[model samples]
Target: MRVNKWGVGVILAASVLLTGCAGGSDKPADEKPSGAAQEENAAPESDCPELKDGATIDGAALSECVTEAMADSAGFAAKMTTLGMESTSRYNPAEAAVATDTTFGSVVVIGEDAWVKSATGEWQAADTASTDPTVVALSTAAKAVDASDPMGVAGTLSGEYTVTGTGTRLGQDVFLLTGVTEEGGTSVDMVFELTSDYVVLAATGSTELEGQKIESVQEITEWDVEQDIIAPL
Candidate 1:
């Protein structure tokens, strides 16, 4: 893992934000995004917030720790799942990639440019800068890092965060955090899985819209690991 990482984001952050930037399709997809190797630093465990079982910490402190760790990431890959939609993303400092498979189809974007998988499973160049509102919306997903989050991420959901206690995720010890995040004037209940050194392992949230409960999950599978991401010509 690289050095210092993470910072809070609007809502659902980057993983959820980028989950479906690509429309859905059934065609075969290209290779996963690639990234170049760059070594970074990671916050030592001792420097992180102390987690005690059944203890509580201020939400703002938890949020700050997560925010810092996310920004310090050297490379990472993650998935976001919601309403039967699943997306995979990979990021390193040099590049990033996001792919979503859903009814709209599959898509890949690097910076402001995009590529769509044709019905025949071929990659077609997409103009993210087009005047079309739909196209513009797709490009709006653009991030400073190769049209994506600098971390192969979208970003993270941030709010007044409170650490409920300590726990484990996928076998790694972690701090469990709870908070409510809002965007567009809508609020959702969110739970975060954070590592000892402040690495974000996953975050999940839910909200009611039109009397229907909607939920989203962000799972960080890799942190500060090696990654390879490349853009299609």
Candidate 2:
């Protein structure tokens, strides 16, 4: 697919939210607790499968948990941030909305249509033909959200990772998993945060493209919440 600027930005944002920088630390340096206190305050160990340092995750179990959570939820919303891009997206399966702010300008997608807000503050239709990469990516992302298949994106990297019980996110205790992928002399690091229920709350990662380095972070919430998505007028 021809990756447009907007498409690349969205993909970068979504990927960062779904998976994080591979080798980054998840432990909060300032919040170290004693072993006794950690054990006392931690959720039951059974909540998460035991993961040895530097091992692959249990993909089947992880997928099962994510699928179950998605099946139980009504809808969800997500926010993504990168060096020069920020986006907020919401999905209810049948419909979705995404608003992105980039150094170039603002782009918004509502359902099948995409729009751009110019410097003069006029909203106009983006060139979102069926063959357009941005349109295809946005559509696929919405469908994935509707399917509640978080693993469809991150589950592909299910092996050889170190896991640690780490800091809180969105007020939920999480397990931080990190991994790396090397190709064409470039190494990308990714990190993922999973909640007690196996739900993925956030992901961040860094990679290089066209000789430029890109880093991104993403957060998702409102699982099973009632969300009504509408087209922008």
Candidate 3:
């Protein structure tokens, strides 16, 4: 299967997100956290996807579920831990806007208007006039992807998935969904921890190549929390 540009961008950012590892989470399936846990330390989502041990949901359905959650949520917040460095992102569905704080700096985008800040520099609009490579690339990516894309990256994936089992994590009921597809010599795989109601708690992806391997993971540390995202410029 051929992954589109949108999909590739996800791989790169997520890969960059967890540069320290080639493996997914170490938490065992049996002891994993809630599939729909909200706030890393706060309560879990009141509305979540829960399924029986033998129940199942397809990839299309999974994608639709996540997409709905993204479009419907009033606001969304998540903390991504990569290589011991953390970045927290807040998304506003009403305005199709997002604000992210990374170890290196900060990024904010509202519609086609984007801004970037360096760890020690002031926020600058990442407009067409920008010459900085990173700013240029970020601007391109922001305009290319559908605003809904960032909220649920797994929803952007192409393939199928079904419930593997069920359990309790972070005091919330959880389900496991998995799928894998291959084209030619390349194989792609995805794993998602979901609330039976369809909220994503975590997602992981990996693929293999001759003599080389790559993997990326983004575990949701918080979800649907308060946010005050706005243009920095």
Candidate 4:
């Protein structure tokens, strides 16, 4: 896997948009909010490989779904593959320090630095660097549709997501992204965090590969951007 400088730059830049406040001091005991209730019902299970909130999604499984979706989608697969290769090459086992409700946690090796929020409000050095934007776009778009590839312009860039479970990357709480697709498939899953009010924090990837598979898993543990959250401009 080789890194594409141009693509990485674009994604890294876009990542700057993700910025928010992190907890510094501990909340007073009386003021601390209660944690969310544990889901009592079992997520709906199925062969469609949708990621439900609170469950783990296998990387290989995600790749298969992506590949299948991209079968006839022109060069989508190629782009994703390139990103996958790039990501694997640069996926160093490093820790990312970021804010949490209690203490700060790290997201390790979050897919080659797609961008992260640091103490300041700008993109900073992450465990890994980002892949090309084209690749990032294709993969993310595909995942949104619960489809394998970006065959048509029928995908969403943003939507509501619930945290079904959590995973640790360098001991940080990376939320497990899961929810049933309103159309087909079960719920799609990804490891993510809330970068800002609108952005979903994550590393770059070929998350949706050919043959409907997940080719890579990028774990993130920190953000190093350089702008202040109160005034990120």
The count of residue-pair clashes in candidate 3 stands at: 9
* Between candidates 1 and 2, the TM-score winner: 1
Q: Per-residue lDDT for 24-53 in model 4, tens only?
A: 222221221222211121222324244445
Candidate 1 local lDDT, residue 118: 32
Give each model's clash number.
38, 15, 9, 50
* Model 1 per-residue lDDT tens digits across residues 87-149: 555655445444433333345655455665533344556545665543343334332233223
The better-scoring model by TM-score among 2 and 3 is 3
Model 3 lDDT per residue over 70-148, tens place: 5555565655543344556677767878776665556687777778765556778765457765555555444444556
What is the TM-score of each predicted model, taking all chains together?
0.64, 0.56, 0.69, 0.25
Relative to the unseen true structure, what is the C-alpha lDDT of residue 171 in candidate 4, on a scale of 0 to 100? Answer: 24
Clashing pairs in 3: 34-169, 48-197, 49-195, 49-196, 49-197, 49-198, 50-196, 50-197, 59-161
Quick one: best lDDT, which candidate? 3
Best of the candidates, TM-score: 3
Model 4 TM: 0.25
**Local distance difference test scores for all models:** 0.51, 0.48, 0.54, 0.26
What would the per-residue lDDT of candidate 2 be over residues 36-154, giving only the tens digit for each residue?
22331223334445544444676544544554544344555555566645555554543445444433344555555666543335555664344645444443433333233432333
